[model samples]
Structures are given as structure tokens and as C-alpha cells.
Target: MADIIIKNVYVLTMDSYELTQGVVVIENGTITEVAESTEQDADQIIDAKGSVVMPGFVNTHTHAAMTLFRGYADDIPLDEWLKNYIWPAEEHLTDEDAYIGTKLACLEMIKSGTTSFADMYIHMNDVAQAVKDSGMRAALSYGLIDLGENRSADVELSKGKQFVLDWKGEAEGRIITMYGPHAPYTCSEGFLSKVKKEANHDRVGIHIHVLETESELNQMKQQYGMCSINLLDRLGFLGPDVLAAHCVWLSDDDIEILRGRGVHVSHNPVSNMKLASGVAPVPRMLDRGVNVSLGTDGCASNNNNLDMFEEMKTAALLHKVESLDPTVLPARQVLEMATTSGARALGIKSGVLREGYNADVIIVDMNKPHLTPVYDIHSHLVYSASGSDVSTTIVDGRILMQDYEVVCMDEQDVLDRARTAASGLVERAKF
Candidate 1:
């Protein structure tokens, strides 16, 4: 007997053009079978007749606890938004606030078919706990910064290292740990180099922001007499273990550096557009064979949502318009960016539905009026389908949501706690 079996659904393995009527069998948190028919019985069987089963989305970059700051500061530049409002507001957040905020984020992501994510923020222990309790997979890191603040570089790096060591493979191997140095402008060169060394020493990955805005590019040139890419490269900090977010203001040379170093890029189109950060050259990066993945930075900068479906649609449309070519990012490629590319960025095995793979999957209901005529499944998924279309989300062979009902966590309780937390945060921040 298997642990669970899902039958009567169209399986989009994402490994190949294997979209067909099939049944998927799960056992021991892994996919045991995916084929036309399974002769196996399961303790729990799900008959998903009118849905398409595929890999769940992996968010490559996010500040999960920032869910508390969603809609709190909107329609502002990245610098002003962060320095004036967001940073000030963050000072008032308690551990309980971070916990509730992350729980809310996990609830939203699970409901929207996101089974895993990469999160960097303060109070990351609380964030990790929330992810564990919510039954989601995550790569977590403590946001590190050392720019003349009261916290010294050693202290900050020590804290980040503690986080990495404490949660390297926690949550039954569902949580991976990384060292998150906030960004180039925020952290000094010495600090970044130290962080890279620590990450390499621990054999973990490093997540950081790189040139999200023109201002950062300008600041780097002024301060270091070079671009952020060149400075980081000079420090030997660029590598496959680096997850760089928002390469919006990159030059051709910078893109080459990233590709040469085999660094992963997490393109947050929604957050970039919202913050007026320049658009990243995704087509150029893809054309150069760089592994460009998709991410919804955080709720605060992305219309207060973690819906990867919206992220997919926005990425497809944004790149096309920016390049003045409607055929730039096709539906299938955008879907890959959201699923396969993101998984690769996080070094996870959940992006493709295959035997012996992690059972991080979602069933999208295509029977809606909007998705009435299924001319092309890929097209419908990338261009037409929304997060609400997801009827089930399974992570590690566990049914987090089934038939539009969330089973892993209390949905209403999370929402209520989130509201209370947000209210208290507002009072504390006085904004």
C-alpha cells in the first residue's frame, strides 16, 4: 500500500512533454509512481478528475515575515521605502509579530499552490518555526547588515552563522539554511567576504540582493569605483552557491560575470515594477544561458501577495513589453521559470513530477469559466490561471490543501492572528 494516491488527473511532470491522464502514487514523502495507471492501493486516494497535477512553485527570494508590512508602505522608491518607512517599522516588530506574520505568509502561499520558498528576514527562528508548523518547505536565512549600526560586523555575522548552524537541515530536511547578507550598499566589503567564507565553510548557500535599483549601481560605482558585480567578483563572492535577487540594473559585462560564475538570479518582476526599480534583462540573461528563476520578493513590495501564478503572468507580460516582442517569453518558458528554474535556484528536487522525487505538487482546477476552453494547458496555466484555481497543494506527500480545503493549518485562526498582529504593529510603529 502507498501513503497516498491521486488519480484521474492530467499530470504535467515538467520533466518532459508527458502531459496525460495518469495516477501519481506517493510513499514515504516521495513520489513512487506517475503513469497512466497505478496498480497500487493507498491509505488515502484523491480523485481529481478535472484538474491538472504539476510541481508546485518555488519562490526563490522573499522576506516572509514582511507579510506584516504588506500595504504598509506602497508607491515609493526602494531607498525611501526602506530607509524611511520599512526600517523604522521593522524596529517595532517583536518575535511574536514575526511568527504570526510568517504563519500568515505560509498560509497564503500554501493556499496559492506554493509548497516551498526561500526566505530572508529578521527573527528567522520564528520564521522557521512558522514554516515548520505550516508544513511548508523553505530555505531560511537571517537578514544580516553591518553599516555603522550599533551591531558590529562580528556580532551580525555571528548571529547569521548561528542561524545557519541551528537550522541547516531542520524540519525533517524540509528547511535548508543559508547566510543572507542584506545587500552591497548595506554590508561592507569585509563583511561580505567574511559571510562568503562562512557560507563556504559551512557548505551552505548565500542569498543576497544585487543591484535592484539604479541607485545601488550608482552608489557602488561611487564608493568602490566599480559596479556591484565587479566588486563582488573581485571579492570572489560570486558562485553557484549564491542566490542573487533583482539584477535589474546589470550591464552586459555584469551578466557575463554572473553567468561565468554560475550564480542563480531570482527575478522579482512584480516587486521591481512596484518599487520603480528598473526592469531586469531576463531575456538577455536567458539568451546567455544564465539560470534565471522567478520570485515574488515579498508581500510589502508586490501588491501584498505571494501568488506565483500572478508572478508568472507578470513576468511573461513584463519582459515582452520591455523588449517590444510579444513572443519573447512564451507561456511554457515562464512556467519553467516559476517551477523548474526556481527549484534549481534553491537546489531542491520538487520542481518536476517524477518517480523518486519530492511530492511537492499542486492540482489546478481548470474547469472554471475563465479557463473554459483548454486549448493549451501551458498557455492557460501561465496566462489565464490564477492562484484561486489551485484546488489542492501537496508537499512532501502531505496534503496541505485538498479540494479547496486547507488541512495542514488553521486558516481562519491564522488570518485572525495576522489581523491582530498587524494592528499591534501599527500602534507600535505609530505609522
Candidate 2:
């Protein structure tokens, strides 16, 4: 019952084709028409000034509220980071802190041109509420870690079940819930088999970490007598609905297993490289017909900022250098990993800018210094544009950000709350 006309834009339109520019009409949170619209009654008009309009970025896996822990632990091995710094800090988090931290993360994500993301963490009720308030689309999962005795496992399972019943598919259907069993090392075979049963019955998807480190690969091999992927495969864990993050240590057989099972992989290039997790064999995954998407992992590991542009650039160049082939993961394919492929990975219907797709869109300001002399817009977008270059963001036909200001959130208030939360958490964490 409403119309917003975005005009005079270089519209990237991440449709089936590569780069195409045209007008888009958004009505009631769904794109009614894109390009060559004959009807022109508009309620809202945004002059893009030839800025690129593309599908909003889909962050395939992240811990949104972990922004509070950014730089709290760094330059450490994955096991050390988890056991020494991150887990200790996480134990001190309150629901209020999660709310504030997720708000800050959502603000940063929108500003950086991400409309939708998949998140895995604890206190997901706070995270989901924050997503609803910020008007961002997300798939949230309560991470189930049964590291303690059997009692601890029961507690985790209870919390995860409650999260599924309470918050799944909330926020006007902008949010979907998933089951997260942390990873292989923390969860036992019996626990994971139970998780698979829960997933099957609940008919919900799963978001999990997979082969993120050489340690993980080694542990699975030594402890389980199988590769990590094979262990999951034996448990029937990989599916079309399964989204596995950071396949940095996957082998050729592992890639085949994932492809055969239709498992979606999220390539967190920055986070992996930062953790020295090694290259993910992204080109090999692509060659094997895997649905490879993009993600920032978490601000803690990625440093800060949720800019998919930087992630895309890293994904593109990292593969080429790792494979020693210039033709590996070109700009266009890297762009797909952030947009449509990302959507596909998350099992969402709105990756491309077209009719019937959800109105998830971002408008970039092309007048910036780095984006000038626009020879190829896609290349420039992947290689040059930063998160700050995004001028406006629209998700579900509602303008969440315009002229670099977020409409659905108060950035200053979030900043204050997060600062307070961080100080308190540090004190309570005994750090």
C-alpha cells in the first residue's frame, strides 16, 4: 500500500545476470517491480546520483553481540582465545549487556550495508529483541555448549529448547531461529546426535562452526578417528539447511561430502587469516559446486566493523594468493558470495534486487574519492568501497538509514550503553 522510488542509480541489481542498472519499486516490504516500471506514483523518492543499488549483504555467520568483546582477546590461538579470554568474558555477560551490544553491532552492520545476517551466541532473547528494535533481518541461534558434567549439558539443552520455542521466526518473520551445538570439540557424539534429532523434529536450520582451526582437524582425527566433516556426515549433520562457518581445514573429500550433502559454507577470510586458520580452499569449494558465502565471523576476531565489502575483497584476493592463480575467485564471483550466494546460504529468498524478492537494499555514494572514474562498478564495489561509503540502507521497504544516519536506532545512546556495559563486564570478569 506504499511505494518508494529509488531513481537515477547505477543499480547493481544482483540478479541472475552480472551488473545491471535500473529503477526499483518497493511496496509493503517486497519489491513490486524493478527496472522499466510504467506506473510512477511515488510516496518516497531517493535520488541515488548514480550510486550503486544492490541486494543487501547477507552475513552468513557471526556473533552479533560479540562486538562488546572486540579486541578483548587477539593474536592468540583459537583454543587459547576461547578458553582464556572469550569464555571468561562471556560468563560475565548479562541480558542487558547483550541487548546493548547487539544494538551497537546492528547499527554498525546497517551502516556497513548489511541488511540481514545469521548470528550464533547465548542470551539470544536479548539479541533477537535488539534485532527487532533495530529493524534488521537475522537468523539467531542459541549456542549450546555442554562442556561441564551431565548437569551442565542438561542446562544448555534446556536453554536452547526454550530459545527455539520462544524466539524462532519472531520480529515480523524477519528472524529465523537455528540450533547451534557450538562445535565438535565441545559437543560429544551423543550430544550432537540429539541435536540432529532436535533439528529434524523442529524443522529448523542449524548454524555451526566447522574445521575452523588445524587444532580442530587434529582433535577430531585423534579423538574421533575420523575427519571433522566425516564425523558430522556420519551423524547426518550436513543438509541443505545446514550453514557451516569457516571450512579452512576441509580436505578434498570434505569438500565432496559438503557438496553432496548440500551444506552451505561461510568463508570468513579476515577472521581465519587473523587467527592463522589458513586458507579455506575457497576456489576448490567453488569448483566442487559448493554454495560458498561470506561473513565477518565476529567483530572480536575480525577486529571491528561488519563491512561485507572488505570481506569480499579479502575473499577474492586471499584465494588468488593462496592458490597462486589470478583467475581464482574473481571480483564478480566474490560479489555473488556476499549477495545472492550469501542469501542462498542463509536459505533466504531476498538476495537479488528483483520483483517478489524482499526489499533488502543498500545505496552507496559513488562520488567518493576511491570510487571515481567508474570504469567497472562491480569491481570497484568489491575492491574500493568501504562501509562508510554506504549512504542509505533499506530493509523490508523501510528506510533504516539515510544520509549515513540510522533512523531505526539512536547511535549515541547505543554507544553510551555499550561503553557502560563493557566497563562493568571487564570489572565483573576480573580482567
Candidate 3:
């Protein structure tokens, strides 16, 4: 008998630029078949009942451990937000706190139909372990911010090597590790070069914040005498494997540099807008052939929910409002950025529905009023459907969320931990 069969679903394969009605067969932790004719039997079957079954979203940028600090310090410039509140609070974050925070992040991700994410955070082993326990797929980065002399870059690099050694391919290959050099302003050239050296050996990708603020842009221009993207390019930062977050305030030459190097950009509109950071030149970047993906950045800035659908809508509309062109970043491209493009950025396999791919899928309740009279599934997904409409989330052929309920973890317990952690973080912040 087949392992799992999903029947009567409107499958938006996200493959070959099309969507259709079909049944999917999953077995051995991989998608075994996709056929319109549900003329088969299985050990288990889900009657999707006309829901939109599509690939699970991939969050290419997130500070998973920072979910503990969500809404603790909002309504500030990006620089001040980091320096005044976030950095100070992060100092007090222990491994237990990271575990607790990341567990909450994973739960939120599951509830919102995100199956995979690229996460940068401290106490990363805790975050990685949380992913392991939750059965969520993630790329865990040990956020290397060595501003203090006592705790140097060497220490962070050593810890990164240890992460690679210990957890690189763990959790049945669900967890991957990356070298995170927080941002250009936070990392010196010498330090980032060392990170590159380590990353080259490991052949893993590097995650960095690029031009999230005008001040950061000015700082890079004055200090390095180069634009942030060009500075990174000079430092050997851009490549096939690099995933740069934010990327606001980019110049034409910067877009050219990214496109030339085939660097992937993680567009986080929610975080950018929340911090009053200006919109990145996404249209220009796309025109220059840059691989752009969508991310929630983190719960602290976006505030508790890593829904790629919302991100997509924000991205599609943000440009129109700024550029005064409604034609920019249409629904089709937005969905691709969230799904297939995001998977490309993180080097994961299953962004589309097909045989032999990892079974990372989500079923959206298309029967809802918001999604009714679906002219185009892509349009409905991007412009209408909310994260709550996601009825099921499956990763590696394992059903994590089913019928609007998370199956693997206690949802209430996860919420309680987050509530406690948030209160504790606030208490400790009163200094």
C-alpha cells in the first residue's frame, strides 16, 4: 500500500509554471507520484476537499531566536532598534532562551504553513536542536557579532566549525548550517574574510544583512568608501551560495554586482517598512537577473507570524506605492519568490510538486470567502489568502500540521513558553 495519499485537491504544483487539480502520493519521505486520476489506494489518505495544495513556503531570512524579543522594542530606526534595545537584550539570552524562542518560532512557522527557513541567531545549537525536536527543516546560522575583544571572531568561527561538525546534516538532513556575519557594519573586513574562508571549506552559504538602513549605507560609504554591495563584492562576499537579507538602498551598480555574482536576495518588506527603512529596488534587481526571495526577517520586527503569503502581498504592493507602477512585482512573481526562488536561495530541493522531490507541501482552504471565485490561484494566494487558510503543512513526507492543527508539538505549551519568555525578557530589559 502507498504511505500517504492526498485526494481531490486543487494542486498548484508550482512546477513548470502551472496549477491544476490532482492527487499526490507520498511514501518513504519523498513524493512518489502526482496524478490527476486518484485511481489508487494508500495506507493513509487525506481528502483535501478542494483545498489548494502547493509547496510549503521557505523563509530565507529570520532571526529565529529573537522571537523572544517580539514587540519588546518597536517604533524605532533600524540602527537604534539594534543598538539600544535588541543588542542589550540579546546579551542576556541564554541557550535555554534560544531553545524556547526557536521552539516558538518553529510553531509559528508551522501554524503559518512554512516548512523550511534560513535562520540566523545566537545560541544556534539550541536553535538547531529545537528544529530537530520539532521536525522542521532549517538552515541554522551562528550569528557572529564580535564587537567585544574578549569574545572575538575566532571564537565564533570555532563555534561555527563545531556546528558544522556536529549538526550540519542532522535531523535526517533537515538541518543545514551557514556562516552568519551579522552585517557589514557589525563585521570588519578581516573578520568577514575569515568567515568566507571557513564557508569556502565547508562549502556552505553565508547570510548577511545588506543595506537595511540609510545610516548603514552612509556608514559603508564613508568608512569603506564603497557601496555595501560593492564592498561585499570586493570582500568576496557575493556568489552562487550567498543569501543577503534586506538589500534596501541598492544602486544600479550594486544590482549589477549582485546579478553578476548570482547572489540571492531575501526581500523582507514587513521588517523594512516596520523600521522605516526605504524599499529596496526589487524591480531593478529582478530586471538585472538577481534571484530574489521573500522572508519575514524575524518575529521581533514583523511581530509573531512568518507567513510568506503576507510577505508576498506586502512586496507586490510596496513597490507599486513607491514606484507608482501597479505593474511591478505581479502575483505570479511574488508567489515564485516565496516558494521556488526561496528554495533556490537556501539550496533546498522541493520548491515544486513533482515525483522524487521531498514532500514539503501545504494545503490552503480555497473554499473560503476570500478565496472564492478564484480567477487565478496565484492571485488568490498572493492577494487574498491568509496564513490561517493553510489547512495542512507537510515536510519530508511527514504531516506537521493537519486540518488547522499542528500535530507534532503541543501548541498551547509552545505559546505558554513564548509568553513566559517574553515577560522574562521584558523584566530583564528594565535596566
What are the TM-scores, per candidate, against the unseen true structure?
A: 0.99, 0.97, 0.97
Model 3, 66-144: lDDT tens per residue? 8887767788887788888888988888888899899988888888889999998888888999999998899878888
Q: What's the lDDT for candidate 2?
A: 0.88
Cα error of candidate 3 at position 96, Å: 1.5
- Per-residue CA lDDT of model 2 for 322-375, tens digit only, reads 878888888888989998998998778888988899999999999988888888
lDDT string for model 1 (1-431, tens) is: 99999899999988876756899899999999999998899999999888899999999999998988888878988889999999999999999999999999999999899999999999989999999999899999999999945458989999999999998899999999999999999999889999999999999999999999999999999999999999999999999999999999999999999999999999999999999998999999999989999999989999789999999999999989988999999999998999899999999988999998999999999889999889889999998999999999999988999989999988999999999999999998899
TM-score winner between candidates 2 and 3? 2
Candidate 2 runs further than 4 Å off: 18-21
Between candidates 1 and 3, which one is better according to lDDT? 1
Highest-lDDT candidate:
1
Instruction: Tell me the spans in candidate 3 whose CA falls farther than 4 Å from its real position.
Output: 17-19, 148-151
Each model's lDDT: 0.93, 0.88, 0.87
Candidate 1: clashing pairs of residues: none
Largest TM-score belongs to which candidate? 1
Model 1: what TM-score? 0.99
How does residue 245 of candidate 3 score in lDDT?
95
